[model samples]
Target: MSAPEPAKKPNAAPPVTRPVFLARATYRQRRMRDAAALLPILGALLFALPLLWLGQNGGEARTSHVMIYVFAVWAGLVMLSAVITRILGIGAAPQSASDDAGAADTRRG
Candidate 1:
């Protein structure tokens, strides 16, 4: 059996304690998350605003204008969402092992 170690001195300083917790979001990541959450709501509001205005004004037989406005709003929102996603690097191609291998092969040849 191993000899017993000497006990720690009572005068020694105690070890510092740290709190246990899961990983937290960084500032940029938190902002991206917030933006992602608000995007759909913003899109919905944009879609409804024109309709609400037209309904309030009570236009007579302007179905074509309403249809045009609705579709335009929808298309604009879709483009805006695409732009935001691209800016945030969302849905971009991931760098995988296969891609790295292909790149290495090309470099050799």
Candidate 2:
């Protein structure tokens, strides 16, 4: 027969376990931050897309079309940034006077 397992002490606390998932708000904030981080890369790729068009049709891509595309991409990126910032509550909090004073003190030191 197999030996019996040792019993846990009666007074010992149960082992703590981490939560399986983040809270809804925390998960959303993290996702927003991730989107914010990826925004620049997405913009870079979008801007580079026009270059690919330049090589197509024997370099016949129209300058006006490219300009329009560039502007549209720029506007889209700005809007996306604004949305992410708003969702993440970036700069939403009012700055306290003490915070400014701390900065000033740091600069003087």
Candidate 3:
């Protein structure tokens, strides 16, 4: 059994609240990985701007359809190579687990 108390302190400390959530640094790492994905898209946008400008006159090609088809295939191969390299991490993902670990150590250090 406990006795009831009726006492008041004139200067009581305020109640404290702590934040409820925390995040992993790997989240930032994943964000950087996603940003690496955006590079090819940036490159494509860069390539598109000049084509858009050139076609601003809305002129048709004088060559036969075969020429257009061949160029399309050539462009496809180049874009495919870019996509494959980007997907395989040739851009900015820094190539090695060793590098990732070294970065982590550097950040900590």
Candidate of highest lDDT: 2
lDDT for model 3, please.
0.62
Residues 1-109 of candidate 1: C-alpha lDDT, one tens digit per residue: 9999999898988989866753454556667777877988987887776555544366553677778978998898788777768767888899999999999999999
Candidate 3 regions exceeding 4 Å error are: 1-24, 54-109
**Candidate number of the best TM-score:** 2
Query: What's the lDDT for residue 4 in model 2?
Result: 100
TM-score of each: 0.52, 0.70, 0.29
Give the local distance difference test score of model 2.
Answer: 0.92
Pick by lDDT: 1 or 2, better one: 2
Candidate 2 collision pairs: none
Runs off by more than 4 Å, candidate 2: 1-15, 54-57, 95-109
What are the root-mean-square deviations of the candidates from the true structure over C-alphas?
10.5, 4.8, 14.0
